[model samples]
Target chain A: MIIVETKNLSKVYNPDTVPVHALRDVNITIEKGEFTSIVGPSGSGKTTLLNMLGGLDKPTSGEVMVNGEKITGMKDSRLIDFRLKNIGFVFQHYNLIPVFTARENVSFIMLLQNRDKNEMMKRTDALLEQVGLGDRKDARPKEMSGGQQQRVAVARALASEPKFILADEPTANLDSNSAMNLLDIMERMNREEGVTFIFSTHDQRVIDRARRVIKMVDGAIAEDTLISVEAANQ
Target chain B: MKTLLTIAWRNIWRHPARSGVLIAAVVAGLWAGVVTVGVLNGMMDQRLNNLIESELTHIQVHHPEFLDEGYSRLFIEKVDEIAAFLKQDERVKAFTKRTITDGMLQSPVKTSGVRIRGIDSESETRTTNFHTNMMEGEYLDSSIPNAVIIGRTMANEHNMELGHRVVLTFEDVSNQLTSSAFNIVGIFESAGTDFDRRNVFVRSSDISSILYDKAVFHEIAIMLHDEPFAQSLAADINQNFSGITAQTWRELSPELNLIVEFGEVMLYLIMLIIMAALAFGILNTMLMALFERMREIGMLISIGMSRTRVFLMIMLEAIVLTLTGAAAGILLAIFSIRYLSSAGVNLERFAAGIAELGWDHMIYPIMSTPEYVTVVIMVIVITLLASLYPAAKAIRINPLEAAKDS
Candidate 1:
């Protein structure tokens, strides 16, 4: 079943003076358990599409229906609530609170939800261990490496128990080894837990690992293609 | 709220040196303001106390016509009855009747106009304690005929001394001129040089014998244990007596009262000025804090922290900064006030300005509990007001743009 769908989504920046078409008439859908990557060259609307899909930016013209509910028309305040409850985001940089420890960072979303303390702690510990930073739970963002901090961000994104996560170039700042390890862990989580993820990236490594790749040109989708297991292995 | 405070509290320490400097500035500002105002308040209090003790008693009564310059038109009727009434009133701690007249005071070589007060010496001493401040000879030896006590300034200006007889010329009640040679039996020096020069005291019986057809008085000065009740007592006296005007110390010395009130206004003004300076320091620091953490703030909002919560967090940060600093400052001030109040700050070095103003050369810093509490409350209020600018700046930021700032 499709967990996310967008219909004819468009976004324009500085529309009155110097209109920049960031996204145009984008139509896309992602199903549960799919590992998707939205890929494009520079200034090709990949990140804008992700932003529209995540409800961080309102589309100038069209609908973003996640789980069959239109979120594009929601107020900014209600959009925040919707994002907190039903969606997660991982930015290019780690974006972990510099003052919060790794475990606290992971637990922040649950804290926003005002969840039970013991339950939140248990889930946070499990998420940290799953990200392979179990022993580094007390480490602050500044005290951790780029890869470690991104893992913390991932754990944070998952803490709200959202239906899907949108990662915007999650490994852009990582070294090659850290990038591979982070992609491997995300892929494993996608396969084992059926946690849907759609990320925007220019990285070929991320595009190679995605079960499906959506390519963009200018501001609209140019190609949407699925990779078979055998073809992906080849 | 807990989440907001946690973030705020931690954010303050993110740059310990910067936050510490802000706190230190707050501490130093409050300390200087409180101590300076306290010392000024002490000086004003001393000035008032000296005025009341050495000269103006708490309440004074005069025949309405008697406030003019010469003794010819000034004399209170029914003096014995008024004196009897004052002696019976429990609120009247002490009272003295004076027969006052402006006259030419003739020394051996020079002459000066003076206000001659005919006083029952013992009663005058009880009312003003001028006897204690007498610097030479004796306080009106009634045994010596026509004995007089002159102030130091008048004695110095005239080159007069003890046992030097000066002829005083004035108008009697019949409008006839009279003169008498009264021996200077004592000399007294007081805080006010002008007051010392203008006033000279003589035995009431001696002057009244020549000036009045019957026993009478020009004024009645009343002292009280509760100085604040002076106005009420004066009102009572005025109402009870048909032809007299009873005035409180404040009414008699309006300019002095104005100066004391102005001193109070100056205390608040000082607080406002200090707070204004400190407010800018805090605003600059907190704004810098918010600017530096724009990405983090954007991340928080993007993840769903409400703008109200963000606003509250920034405000909490400002409050913590001010409260911490002001509390430390007030504590430090309390300690120093206690020490300086007991040990006293000697202003003999500022004798020309302070001592010449008729206050003692030493001042004890004075801040009552209510005043200290007022200072603390004012600081907290000013800090809350100061936070509005920075908190609005924090909340007005667009998360999308801020997150993209990189």
Candidate 2:
């Protein structure tokens, strides 16, 4: 059930002028339907690992395979197509398109997939309703609260039924109450819908809710721990 | 594609004040460009039309030797048949025959060299504006012996009034120097003072008796319903008629043709410069907007929108911006031009200067549909060209760098 695997992956920025190792020989695997968190302090390469795992950036050296298909050697255009069918992303600042209404934001990915209108509408409505923005479907991102925008981003990510969703510091900007509400919804989806998710976060709230925790120090994995059975029963 | 266009359209309004300023600039630029070119073109057309109507009729037929100064031998024969043919021709609006001779007019105070025309009063007025140009006295009368007309400028120069007698000296058919005295019955001043002072008119009967038979003429001027068909008509006349040459107004007055060509080139050049300025404004605005949304655009790329679609979105935004502005400009231009065209833009204040170019005191501004279509197409092309640099920049943005907090 492994959805994404990275072996001996490394990324170096400005190698010739001033070499800075962002991620060094990192190895990781993410299984389907698993809610996991990749935790590290600033500059510890959590973002770099997530970027390569999602095919958003190329590793300086190594292999990245999603659903058993190697993506490291794929052409940029083909990688984009592959990512559309296999991966979704959520940013820290709730990067939902500012011009589109909440419903339009959710329907965007389905439109890219060329989904049928009726089915796309049904799915968009269902996702927005699940994210508790059903009544706020026509509201634009600027009109929504920070937490609501993030929920719309989550709904948009799910619109294409991507195999896994990668979220970078997803709750870093939310207040305590909004943070808890967002985490509650995400945890509920993780349990009920069996949607695979991976997060790069410094937020303890997201870390506490996730069933698996992958910790990194100095661009290398220091720990990988699973507590789904224990966390689910709690 | 529909989704991309909708997103592009909405994106432009993200900064409504900024986009509004850009659109307003485009609208103002186009309005000014169209109106200026329209008025200038109107002036040129009016000048040409007046030349055709008041001075040079559409086509003129002359004896091969008529251009030289020998007035005795340069006369067209078979005149009655030519006049009859012209009357039966459907394209001929009017025609007049004249006997021309170079002579000197002597008054008590002074004298001047002039081309003396012997015009049949009835047919003369039909082909040209001679009847309407009379400022005093009357048009030529065959009944009054030795009756003549002189231009107002010439009369003023000689300090002569109506009923003043002037002397004309010219050669007879036998090349004999003949002299006669005539009464100035009318004084007329048309568009230009220079043209008026250099010519005089008299009844063809008064002068022709000394040169040839009463019916002989040196020149035949013809006016046509459709001015553009003059060249073809002249060709037909030249091929069928014998012992005569036919020439169009364009051939006779090459300066007028030159003005028309020059005016059109200047108009297009002015429009091109304005559109280029408007294009720069669009490029600056779109580039700023794209740069502001670099991370969002990066996120869009990460979320699987193709680079081509991203490029198209930015270009679409530019096109939509120009189309809205250009549409508004066209509306404003149409309304203002239509109003001014009916009311007329008077040039009487500039008449003295305008008259030098044979232009009238009033001009009507006009723009044809093809000119409007050209403006629209040119605006769109300018906008599309402007979008290239920014679109290329948008596609080159790296998602990883944009997503990182600096």
Clashing pairs in 1: none
Over the true interface residues, superposed, what is the Cα RMSD of model 1?
1.5
Query: Candidate 2 regions off by >4 Å?
Result: A232-234, B68-72, B78-81, B169-178
Among all windows of ten consecutive residues in candidate 1 chain B, which has the lowest summed lDDT?
Answer: B351-360
Q: State in Å the error of residue B174, model 2.
A: 5.6
DockQ per model, Cα: 0.62, 0.72
DockQ of 2: 0.72
After superposing candidate 1, which stretches have Cα over 4 Å from the reference? A228-234, B69-73, B87-90, B129-132, B135-145, B160-165, B175-177
Clashes of 1: 0
lDDT of 1 at B281: 89
Q: What is the TM-score of each candidate against the true structure?
A: 0.92, 0.93
